[model samples]
Target: MSTSTAPDAKTVRQVRPALRAGRFSTVLRVPALVTIAVMVALLLVLFALDIAIGDFRIPIGRVLDVLGGGGTRAQRFVILDSRLPRALTAVVVGAALGLAGAITQSILHNPLASPDLLGITAGASVGAVAVIVGAGGGAATGTLALVGVPLAALAAGLATALAIYLMAWGKNTAGGSGVMAFRLVLVGIGVNAALMAVVSWLITRASLPDASMAQHWLTGSLNKADWSTLIPAAVGLGVTLLVAAASARTLAALRFGADTTRMLGVKIQTQQGILLATAVMASALATAAVGPLAFVGLAAPQIARRLLRTPGEPVIASALVGAIAVLGADLVSRTMFPIDLPVGVVTAAVGGPFLIYLLVRTNRKATL
Candidate 1:
């Protein structure tokens, strides 16, 4: 064997990336772990920012005191009523989107699928729009914005999922996952357009006040969020998360293939129903709270997957990534504009181009 001189520092540095990457592969992929950990840190920072940076600055000291123990009534009120509600809403909504994105993509086995493109968000919008325009007027706009149309959104999400499944199932009667996916996407496109039409009709019928309320809701803001909206959304999300964690194995299995699922003796039909139902409920509740933020659900999970490069949907990872994305967007929205922009508007602006990029990417991958 030929003896070589000692490797220089530059050569060692050059080899470090591949070596570290290899070592990382032996572990559970550090990027996913880092992303999640960073998200948690960012979440904490965002909460502090929310507390300290609003119009009435409480000072970080008082904010902590308000969170922990004794503070004056005014400080308590600011923390409890203002910053707390907004922070909580952001966290809850983020978690819901993350979970919703994971389940949607897992069940459908399509990285590109999301409520935005899949029309679940649209369906929720239709429901919320109906309530905003058709039901209670100005007096109840706040409550109606979050609650009145929530059921309608839930119903629409479920109905749309059922339609896709039934239509896709019928088409795949003889065989083929490829055809099922294609036709289901095609159907989603049609449903999305149709739902937009319904929303338009409702907007026209809305009184000026109602229409303005609906407009605000449609753009998807968390500015007016309060405790009244938080409880129901919390309940919806809490219940759904337990169900998702319990069903992860089956959900993961589904990503491989339906036939693999069948072979593994997983009740593909029943499990799928559970996954889709949980997705619908969580998504509807989040949408109702946040006003049909169509794109986050679509964009978040894909970003998580690309970042992590995990074998399957990486459900927990996706959820954390989503929480970060939404909260980060909200933080920027609040600070970036002279007036605090709505979270939904910010998400749509960021997520829209990401959607187009995904479509192009999918096309390229399909061709490859």
Candidate 2:
């Protein structure tokens, strides 16, 4: 056997790439754990801030006391009845939207792929609007109508998603390959436009009071949040979160390439369907609970990925980021502004510019 010696310059050069990759890999190893911890802590702090900064402006200490069930009756009402449920709704809705966005973007390998853009939210709006307009809007107040609103949204959103999928199916439906990303997005845009027009027509047909209520729901607000809203949001978010977490590995693998995923023995089409359905469910549930908040699903996942700098989808991070984004937007709408704007409006204001920037960058790159 030949004795080994210190490597020469040529050998060292050849081995440098492996060494570099190994070093780079370690940066994400420990820091990834730290990043997740930081995110959780930050989310808790933000949640507290949201509770503390409302009209009465409870101190953080008092907020904690109220949460712990030691505050006065008025404080209790404000915290438990008013603020707590709304805060919880914001957190869950944000998380669901973020998770949905991450899954959609990852599956389609498109930054712009989100439930809102795909017209899933519009479909929810259509369902909710139909119920409201059909029921005579403000006159439709009953326990049944409350229950029906969310059910209608879920059904309509799912149907809308099914239609988009079928329309975008193309020849890829036969195999394990997923729908083409661009084609899916394009079809989604068209469907969204058509659905929006239907929503407009429904609003126009309703009485003034009903139209106003329908408009409020369409704008998306947490002002109406109560136990009723919280229940469905919680159940939906919990179920979808589990499904997404369990299938995260398969979803992440698909990010590499279809050929790589197939070679690794993943059923690409089935996996895609599972992930897409989970995303749709998450989006529909959030919309059902608090109306459709624009851009949370679009912006949250991208923000989380940028923060984590991970090759895989930052599923947990996305959820946290989403919760933070909605809560932050709501806080601003409540406090910083003269009037309480719909949380969806704030999100749209932020997301609209970001979307434009993304489009511009994408176009420039394609042109180059």
Candidate 3:
């Protein structure tokens, strides 16, 4: 047999970079994978704890037994009828918000680009509050009121997102990266402020009982979590997450700037539009499920990115982190307070300090 010919310098150069890139990817993947595994374990623990620790404390063994369909009627009612739905709703809402936030931040290339700050949540609040006020202090019972709130919130949230996108779009700044991002955030803030004012006005005009109900919901309580709400929320979250998985490559490319993304054969505007739409759907669904959760969306992705040490937002990790955050916050609200506070209160308290930290850190880096 004849001896094989040696590779040329050109082939060697091409292969070297490919090999190096493969190794680099492997190095990144291992840590991220490990982090995800840990988060998954933590989520399971929190879920179980949430179910087990309540006014009537069910042991972990009893919780597991109830889950497996072997517990008594009382246990079944407690775990299956009451606690399970709330815990599951928390997980679904958290994951949806987290995923939405990750997608938003990645698309906008800004750490602060969350549905909460961008007026999407506020829009949902407007819709829900309007419905609550219209229902005469949430007295409107039956299927219409039950279904109407979520539908209204979803519609309003999507509308607000569309408005923000249209308002932020500028022919002159379309070519520039930083200008569009800054403009979008600024417009979002203005819109959010306007929406909050509208919510306040609606609440004020509402009767006392109605205003109380509206205010409670606005605080993002899980008191209304039942099978009816949880099922739809979970299904919507699952479908949207699948869409997000498909858009992963596009998101990664987007982080490389619009020019580079276009160079890589992505239809920049179209892809970004689709991703934004997906984010809006996810956020709206979550908001529909559990009113407006302030910082779960804003904080989850950044925490995940930092933990994973990934250059771009890690979608799955962000989801896990978000679910854990909300569930943990709910647990704290229920257990730590003299009276059970809304989950939103704890998140805002913690997230406020976290936001300030992020701002200070970013400023320091900019100065350097």
Candidate 4:
């Protein structure tokens, strides 16, 4: 591929000045902060609504008292035990998925690079299902399933990512970023399909009890949430997100082009390693917590980027936007009809069309 610009320069376009710094700078920080703050407030209001709109109504003051550990016993039991866990779970899982999507897309340089798009969720489901079918929900069994499932998913995903990345790099390591993006997404589709086939096979072999359990988990319900689940996710998310945020500037330069980034003093191998590790951990941890809800990462960052309209990755906006996406999808699932649909169904329904639109837009722009 010959690259030429301005009549004679060929073979490698210079990185644009705007994307060179690897940071958001003044242009991005202000609106990003405002968007993030609004998302938090909106989420809090939605959470309160989630608390209030349950089977019964509780006064806002009373809900606060209940949460603060000084309310009527029944009130305490209802709000403290029920809604709070689920709401907080939504926030954490949403953040994880959002961050996961951002880093995956940034690292691979593809808007469509989501865990669900790449089959990480399916891989996680397969692990979760094998546990359900083979191990019968004993304490040890649940523990092992919880531990084993996401690890398997992460391992499978990382393996798949590495394989695609390596194969793409072999053709021409120097200009492989765009090619890597294409290869990863295409191979991810195949990997995801293969993983789904395995999951189906497991479903076929499962005993009735196992089949039921696996089926429920796959539907992506938040009913299983608790502090036990929330704490681990929070810790995992906190660590991985910090790493990703710290790498924000590096990621910006990355989008400019790797060689440009390297010229600008970014350590290519190290940054890529950390980025992949962070993306994988954020994704694996979220998958462990909630069984993969389809489009938290993909939708959140895209939403944030559209709103922010700045150069480079919308890391912070993406996180806040992720929370909104998850909460919004869950709200729809909860109140869309008499029977609450699975959260995954809501996300899939919303994300699928949105994704098609993005693909078409990219295709048109490419042709233009």
Candidate 5:
């Protein structure tokens, strides 16, 4: 004869924590899933709208037809050859920057942390500008110019990231403690200022034509987007994002402070190194594709966090928000302005005010 028994106090205690963790995960996941679905829908709409509204202004229906491989010659040429590449480039670059920003912000536990603010983009700009100046205006042509600029940008950006990391490193903060977030940001800002000065000086020294070309690129235009650049960038970013997604649990743990993260069995320094490198690669690729885009990185993750009501940045949602933001900015630049303005200009106008709001909000929270 067997007797039924209730769980003991210790068993209950362990089971209760597990149950609560499961419930909390479910609660967090549902909201994030819903947010992602909505953003995907919004991105699709913006993408269709972008393809439909150009010099020729094809109807949305026709745009769909073209996409489905059933449209007239002119429609096909305009959509496939002219408009699609630029729109896709916007999506790719925006997503890359957004993911990079989200990772940087979350791992560092700083809302203001972004590739732009941390000097990654500035370093890329310096490299790209150097290429333009070295090659002269028209001399930098064909495969070398096309490939050389991005490679230089990636190299320079990685070097800059390395510099910031070393400068931010301290004896006390070394070992398992990792670099402090605040110190990293301060060093990054100083590096960013210095790099921008170098870029300005380089431009000033160049000839009129070279300077104009560099200046135009520095403004971050999609006019340079081609299948050659876009394909490689998209593939690289996709792989990096996969790595980031796999590290999602580590990122979540990191937010709870170093002791808690260590308790959770995450090697803090190793994870930070991997995440920071992933972020730098993403940012460098995007900057290489389109010159350093301004606040897509800074704004998208914050916007996603608010929209999802998540305590930390939602990587996928932030990426979609970034794609929408850039695509929308590109649309507005193309349609709203008498002259087609650089997409960067439109983003800066919007992001400048958003930055101010963030500063004000952070100040208010501190005061309280």
Candidate 6:
């Protein structure tokens, strides 16, 4: 009886992994795919609406015709040259922000831990403004001008992240690690405030045209979208998404506390660096493309987790959600107003209320 039981226990251990694997595939993986599909379908619809409903209101058929190089020159101009880039910008930037938000929230293990909160976006903003103000009001001329804005933004964002990490690292009096997360958030807030002040001063010092350009960029307009912005954004989105997917397992392990993850033989700091770098690049490039669009990064990941009912950060789902939110907001901003509004304004109006609700609910739960 003892021998038989021993064999049975060994078999159970073997079977358990198989069961969990099957469960993961069925439960989490399949649902995520389905969510992505649904999001893609919704995006297609929104993209069509956005491209088709301008002053002329081109039909979907004609839009497709222009896309296929079969439409008249005027139709082609409306669909291809003008609307296509802006719509693509919304999708690319949104997806990037969504992915960035998901990674940051997961690693920090805080709902409020996002790029905007962590000063990354503010850093990008500062970089952009400096370029704008320095270049006699941000005109896109001279050598290396085309790539300067985004590169500066990216470098500044990375620098901000590094600064936060360094500032947050402190040894306790007992010579042990103190509370890193709390320190990170606190430092980030301070940095963000300083950066914003710098941006304001720079704008004030710029020439009228340059100041106007700076202000428009700060508002986060898709109206300024062109092939130049769109192409780089698309490439960045693809690269970041791939890197995020590659780092997903490490990201998931981070939820188990650092010691346990370390015991599992993962190089914790290396993985964290990869994830942090990816998040910063994603957010920074997106900001460079569309200015610092707020709340999308803070809101998209949480929304995706809720939508997917996942314990882990749903990076793909979050990306889809971000894209949908941006695309939808862009449509509303352009159409549902007396004049076109900035996409950031629309997101802020919606996200501000959502954030308030989150705070209230969190407080209520804590009190209860």
Backbone clash numbers for all candidates listed: 0, 0, 1, 1, 0, 1
Question: Residue 71 error for model 5, in Å?
Answer: 1.3
List candidate 1 segments past 4 Å from native: 1-31, 139-147, 173-179
Per-residue lDDT of candidate 4, residues 1-368 (tens digit): 99975655675565432333555443335555676788779988777766766667788778878877798888887888887887787788888888778877877778888877876666666666666677764321445645665566556556655655555553446644434567767877887898889988998887777777677777777767766666656776898778876776788877766678879899866787678766766676676666678777788878878887865457777877777777777777787669877777888788889888889988898899
Q: Report clash pairs, candidate 5.
A: none
Q: On residues 1-368, what C-alpha lDDT tens digit does candidate 5 reach at each position? A: 99999888776643212225544542336556777898899899999999999788999999999999999999999999988999899999999989999999998888889999999999988887898888955435667556887788888888999899888876453354458888999999999999999999998999988898888888989987877668656875897789887998898898887778989999988898888887888888788777888999999999999998888998888889999999999999999989989999998999999989988998898899
Candidate 6 residue spans exceeding 4 A from truth: 1-29, 141-145, 172-179, 365-368
TM-score of each: 0.87, 0.90, 0.91, 0.85, 0.90, 0.89
Candidate 6 or 4, higher lDDT: 6
* Winner on TM-score (4 vs 5): 5
Which tens-of-lDDT digit does each residue in 82-126 have in candidate 3?
999999999999999999999989988888899999999999889
lDDT (CA) for every model shown? 0.77, 0.85, 0.86, 0.72, 0.86, 0.84
Model 1 residue 7 lDDT?
A: 82
lDDT digits (tens) for residues 1-368 of candidate 2: 99989878776544222224643432235566788789888888888988888778899899999888799999899888988999999999999999899999999888898999999989988998888878753644556455787788889999998899888876554364457778999999999999999999998989998898889988889988888887877887898889987886788788977778889889887888888887888888789888889889988888888787876558888899899899989888998889988998999899999899878877898899
What is the full ranking by lDDT, best candidate first?
5, 3, 2, 6, 1, 4
lDDT (Cα) of model 4 = 0.72
Model 2 TM-score relative to the real fold: 0.90
- Model 1, position 334, has a per-residue lDDT of 83
Model 1, residue 43: distance off in Å is 1.6
Residue clash pairs of candidate 3: 137-210
Better of 2 and 3 by lDDT: 3
Superposed model 3: Cα runs more than 4 Å off: 1-28, 172-179
- Ranking of all candidate structures by their TM-score, best first: 3, 5, 2, 6, 1, 4
